[model samples]
Target: MKFKRYASSFLLQIALAFFILSCGNSAEKKAAEESNTETTSVETKQKTILFFGNSLTAGYGIDQDDSFAGLTQARIDSLGMDYKVINGGLSGETTAGGLSRLDWFLEDEPSIFVLELGGNDGLRGIQLSETKSNLLAIIDKVRAKYPNTKIILAGMQIPPNMGQEYTEEFKAIYPDVAKEKNVTLIPFLLEGVAGMPELNLPDGIHPTEAGHKIVLETIWPYIQAKL
Candidate 1:
């Protein structure tokens, strides 16, 4: 009887040990699975779309939320696209200024970069050659950093006050750059918004909130095409 009891007790102990080890293995597997799931979630968050430009892009003279960039983001979100739009615009930013800071923005590795500069340069009556050179350099740096990034050049026009010759050349810069770089071109960023008294603010330079909506419409087609 004593021997039998000892054998039974040993078997029970062995069975308990096996059950404990099995539970531990299951717990470890569950933990590893959760960790993998968390990693995947982080990896699949969203891609970035960067808008690099001047006051027009920065939504100068209006609420930032009412800017074209913000409106565009709202539209994108409504469509459930996995993209995050970043407004890298600065008020009164010239092409030279943009070029100087382009390297810092390139670090973000945006999937799409919308170039909207040179308007300020034109307004300031900066030399057309210098403006074009700065813009070209900016594009080159962007290409070097993100080879596969899609570039959208937003064309801008200045008032004819700077002389018809300067105006024409300044206006041509965008299309020329787009053609040369083989990037997508937004023919005219302020196409419908420009010269419309109702669309513009008192300054007649920056667009009003209503104007930004039109701006969004102007660029939406190009942006959609890339997606």
Candidate 2:
């Protein structure tokens, strides 16, 4: 019933998967791999970068290695920086869900936490007020748990299914939350890749490997600044 609601919005034969059941994402695997090979005091001292969001952050239809989060790890490793990137992107996640699952990721202190939800909320016509509340709550949770953790909010946009007024306001959610909370904001997570058919998979929802590469660039500037 839930999928049926959003699937109707897309005029395509392929169902628009707002929530593709993701078994797991590459970010988790990469984080585990790094943990396994790492043993040095310096590695132990490395700061953590947690990319917390949905399928985009998880690399979705593409190989996890091709996801933007994976590219970020590669870049960090190449630079010999002491930061580990963990992709906490889950498919079919919303702001409320992200908030609920946030505590599990908080067991360890992360130097940075990137929030990348709400697109799913927008797709489902969730109330803007509720979405905003959840965003603030998630940020607050991290701050309360780890005062020193820097936060970055990734802005998201859904197709104009709910009307232009709603779409415009929804797009503003990211900056609004960022300003109210004083966290860094990535203006649009899918800046160059969102609607481009070549950049997305056949589902027309998830990004292709090339798209993730582009996404990596969109997010790198913000991610790089904190490093």
Weakest 10 consecutive residues, lDDT, candidate 1? 100-109
RMSD of 1: 2.8
Identify the runs in model 2 with alpha carbons over 4 angstroms from their true place.
1-44
Model 2 vs truth, CA RMSD: 25.0
* Candidate 2 lDDT by residue in tens digits, 64-151: 8789999999999999897888989999998999999999999989998999999899999999999999999999999999999999
Which ranges in model 1 have alpha carbons more than 4 Å from their true place? 1-31
Clashing pairs in 2: none
lDDT of 2: 0.89
Task: Quote each prediction's TM-score.
Answer: 0.86, 0.80
Report lDDT (Cα) of residue 99, candidate 2. 92
